[model samples]
Target: MVSKVNSQTKPRSRFRSRNKLSIKEIFMWLIIIVLFVGMLKVTTLLAKTYQENQHPDSEVYGVWQEKDVAPYAAEQLIFTQDGVVFEGGVIDTNFYFDGKYLEYQHGDTLRRFKFLNKDLTEMKMLLSSGYQPVFQMSEKFQNNIR
Candidate 1:
């Protein structure tokens, strides 16, 4: 009976040891995880770069003057031909021209805006502020149009 017990115990110990993780296996798994994370980062950067390269809408590109009840641009609110929008000369990196809505990114704070009206001459945007500022096309822009 004692010999039988010893044999059973020896096999159980051998099974448990086989199940244990080897050092080489652990290192291999860590390397795989690191590579996967790196690939994801690279893919995200490429996607963003591609998006930034796409041209903006002709209607959305220009200087705008701010006004009350305005749906869009002005000297106060502006979109450059590049994928850049700024209020005045202070360029805010948190803006984008999506062809539909001006995607404004205010970090952590959520704000809603609406395009009340838009045309070649004027743009009225319902800003986060209670009053809507109307942006008229710049005089320089008008002169250039002719």
Candidate 2:
């Protein structure tokens, strides 16, 4: 009868060890999960901030012309709130702006420009030919167009 009792106790102990979790273990797992969630939240917030910084501001809307040129000879850049008009053509979508630069997406093409002034009155178009054409804001659009 003693041997039978020992064998039954051994099986019960093994079952409890295999099936039950200690409080300390549960607490550790909970901490890990919380840390993971916190990390995810931080990552998401960082991503959102980065995305927000990529868009241009309302100050960029204006009529820009090539700097130091005659009025008739100056090339024009007309920027609306949504897009830009260049070379008599309009690109009405896919615009991105960081604090100092603007990016435009054309069909299979990407154009970049760098701002030269704090007021965003001057900018330079970045081109592959090592030609950075300077443009200066000639006219600004108000919130109301009359």
Candidate 3:
């Protein structure tokens, strides 16, 4: 006698079927993704900062003295690869130059200086009160005083 298969009974699949992730698993995956993205952003920021610190503007990376200072006086501005150093040993690293002008953030104030000549030897500080103080490269100042 031939046996008949029942309509309600189905054959099992040979391959294991994938089940949907539970709410906890989904939340965990989301957290991991967010953390990974955050890490990548921080890494990119650090790399950019490193590159900027490594290569500063060559034209402005030296000591500059006030144009009208006395021969023996030492009123100067020092620029380094790391930052701009003031007389009192204050260093401000947040600075940028766009060829024509250099601007730096100091505490709550933003200071700017404009290049006055093509040789990049002369620059003037642009103050808000309209008092522009000229500065010359240290070497030029020394030559003039001699």
lDDT (Cα atoms) of all candidates against the true structure? 0.57, 0.79, 0.73
Among these predictions, the greatest TM-score belongs to 2
What is the TM-score of each predicted model, taking all chains together?
A: 0.54, 0.59, 0.53
Native RMSD of candidate 3 (Å): 9.0
Best by lDDT: 2
Model 1 alpha-carbon drift over 4 Å, by segment: 55-59, 65-75, 81-87, 91-94, 98-101, 104-146
Better of 1 and 3 by lDDT: 3
Tens-digit lDDT track of model 2 for 24-60: 9999999999999999999999986886666435667
Clashes of 2: 0
Instruction: Note the residue pairs that clash in candidate 3.
Output: none
The candidate 1 region of ten consecutive residues with least summed lDDT is 137-146
lDDT (tens digit, per residue) of candidate 3 on 39-103: 99999999867756753465577788888768677468777666777875756975787567888
Candidate 1 global TM-score: 0.54
